[model samples]
Target: MSGGGTSPDYVFAPHERPLLPGSPATPAHPTSRRFAYFAIGVFVGLTGGFGNAMVTTNLANIQGSLGLYSDQAAWLTAAYLMTNVSMSLLLVKFRQQFGLVTFARIFLPAYVLVTAAHLVAHSYTTALIVRGASGIAASALSTLCLLYIIQAMPAPWRLKGIVLGIGIPQLATPLARLLSSDLLERGQWTVLYVFELGLALISAALVMLLRLPPSERMKAFEPLDFLTFALYAPGVALLCGVLAQGRILWWTEAPWLGYAACAAIVLIAAALLIEHNRANPLLNTRWLASRDILRFALVATSVRILLSEQSYGAIGLLTALGVGNDQLIMLGLVMVLATIAGLAASAITIDPANLGRPIFWSVALIAVGAFIDSHATNLTRPQNMYFSQALIAFAAVFFMGPTLLIGILRALVKGPNHIVSFVALFSITQSIGGLAGTAFLGTFQVMREKFHSHSIVQSLTLADPQVAGRIQSLGGAYGKVLGDPSLRQAEGAALLSQQVTREANVLAFNDIFLLVTVLSLAVLVWIGIRQLRMYITGVNPMSEVLAAMARTRGQ
Candidate 1:
């Protein structure tokens, strides 16, 4: 029960007391309830991830169905991230001020309505509005999943639930890839939204039926918080716009990209300047700028960036070479299984005492996977990629739990105030890191493809006898249908040109693989060196933090 408005404090039984202002209490549940909570968590986690996952993995189909240009389709994704990223800054405080149950009651039903609206949203503008609303509403889903999982697990393993809950949403990507083909076959882009709406309805009903225990409320929102957000939200939205559209619009070719970048910098800088001086800031500027937090953000962002080897490298290569999602069902299954295994392995083997080790292995696995993929030829198929993609998928989920737990522990050791900062920092790293990875990798692939295309095209001329023979052989395939000699020759030349383009794309992808490999190895060495230095100096960075937590828990 909350105290009067003066104290902003509460008194409750230890078991019923919330760990934080916005979070639900950890009161023990009956066995059946725990099982129910676990099941709900799994479903909720998948539900949280699937909506955006479908849009991303099936963007091509959605683009065609909506008759949207590539730039326009990209905005669907940009809109989601734009609203999703900055909303966390407010959502955390909303729970603290209003209580999570009320937070859920409001957002969950709103999310369902927004998802249902997605079904009738045929126009691009309406779809964009729906996506923005979905982003704002769906921001609550991750918290719901984590809360449910925390309730499912007992106290000692409570941190384990946090890790699993954080990682569980990742399973949606592979699952979406596995299922999107069939969903697309069922209907148009709206069909995917139908599936999403169904999942949302299920999750919302579950949450309503099994509401979380009451949480303590506090007057957490400051008047300046809104002012800070006004500056921060637009800054982040602009950055998301640039990253989401830069590669589509071609960064240097678009003047607005430069303008957006400059505007984003100014806006973000102004917000940080305001927060840096505030006694009670929305974002903890000093804590986030600390050495340990900075390192945590870097390691977390680095792994997320490297994880793009699967999405941009393998999937992009396959798409370029005309491989369909239908053909990659088996590969998607492999990835789904690998991701589950990684989630289990990370949860099982997690040593809170040494969170960095799992991250090390994750980066190592990513390096090996990328190196193997670097050898890819035009002959590479989904089957050719099964093992490599599995490695990256496993690494992607594997790194998440430890990386998350590490920052979470550090925040807990500091104080409850820092938890908000850590959560916001973590969310930004993940959302922006993912967008940056796709944007950077896509840009790199495009540039490399042009170079390879130029080199390959320079060598092909009618003067070469082999070239002449291949063109004649290609043109012969059209001979039966075409009566004119010149037309047949022209068609054959066109086919040859297409083949050259495909080969160049393959080469470009291989370069991307190598690029990720190099980056992974570099991150590995950097982290390894720091780890070794800590060992040699007998200075474990997390030991004091963990001991502090252990002492707190013991009391």
Candidate 2:
């Protein structure tokens, strides 16, 4: 179990051991080593997130460059998530069986190779293959980030490292949006991949130069693990495809969507059935089916759905108004700062006795933020969203750490064997939650836009003097360009229709914002009621479970 050299004279605090079995034992470091670890952690974490963030934030531009349609661009994102989510389940065991060194050695080089492929191929099929590889690499890098962060901190502050490791990646989207405009302007999508490739190489180098301390390894994999993964991985991929493409292909319009959904259900169900019968299952279906775990999944998934107000709602609205990423630089800056603030706040205020309170506050802030955004007008720009978007951004990171810890505490309480189950559960809920949220909100916005467009068109009458006056005013703008009055009138009418469509889109986005607000508040109420019930019954579920876990680990 020991490494080649004498192990560092370091010890893990009881609370930290349950996080992962092969986690490096933390030796107290001098200020310089600590600083290096911190820097490496941030770099690794950001690199992991920024890889996908660059593609996702600039999907449209990438699509245009590759001569792809909307749905094709979507497949890139879906392909990434397909492997990213399912890989986490196998990765826990991979780390346990083979150790961090092997995990990184395999994946990091693969990441670089994949990035190189993306740079060279520049084709749709190649892009899909590379993205799937990137997803696996991304999962490894995220784990590496946490490992590095844990090494940086002293035992007393180790938990704070977890908070930062998880929360820092959330900043990538904003960072990507901030930098993508410049990257695209300079050298188009190639510049972006070159940058990612450079980061991949740098991350690999940094990790090699500063290796984590070795830990105990075990023969963690079983035959059934592979069988479960074989069944589960494709099932989740199919579901991810369904969710990602459903809105783009218009749900019922695509026959493939139905078939994919059905296949996903059958595959996942069969996997679960196999696990359900196994004495040593990978997924721990019964524990996951328990009330507390179900509730945790629901709350986690609901928060993800509500968080889409930023991704699908506000961003979509801005795009409709022709506001590009260049114009939203300040907004992205605000989000990054707010996310840092949230990370600090969560770390400082985390309490096992009341882990749910931050979630409450987070949901409240999201609701309030969404409500503020609901009143946006045609003139609304990125500047108009600064405060409200920051609130949501803060809440987004603020809630994640505690939610993760809650599940971790419960999983560790049961036993180390349940760790894989928790990881898989958390990954699926967050990934599928985001996907489903985007699909639902996007579809809803489209439907609302259609309704609003119909209503607005019906209300507009050429006989109305006001409408006539507006048409004349619009026509006057074209007088210098078009000699014929008939052509001018036609141009004016087309412009008016464009205006109406813009208005409808704005109205639809407002409705989406309101829906997010309503859902947030409703979830808040549901959580609050459950918390109150627990209090009245004199039973603190998480506290009791966490305490037992500590005692068991201590023993």
Per-candidate local distance difference test: 0.89, 0.88
> lDDT at 167 for candidate 2?
85
TM-score of 2: 0.96
lDDT of 1 by residue, 1-555 (tens): 221111235345676678788887777779999999999988988998886888889888888888999999999999999999999899988989887667888898998999999888988999999989888887889889888998999878887898899988889999999999998898777888889989999998898788777777788999999999999999999999999999989999999999999999999999988989999888889989999899999999989889888988899999998998899899999999999999999988988888999999999999999999999888888999889898889999888998988898998887787788888899899999999999999999999999999999999999999999888899999988998988899999999999999999999999999999999999999999988998999988789898998788668
lDDT of 2 by residue, 406-509 (tens): 99889888987899999999998888999999999999999999999999999999899888888888998999999998898788888899999999999999
The TM-score of candidate 1 is 0.97
lDDT of 2: 0.88
Given candidate 1, what's the lDDT at residue 116?
A: 92
TM-score of each: 0.97, 0.96
Where is the poorest 10-residue window by lDDT in model 2?
1-10
Query: How many residue pairs clash (N, CA or C atoms closer than 3 angstroms) in each of the candidate models, in the order given?
Result: 0, 0
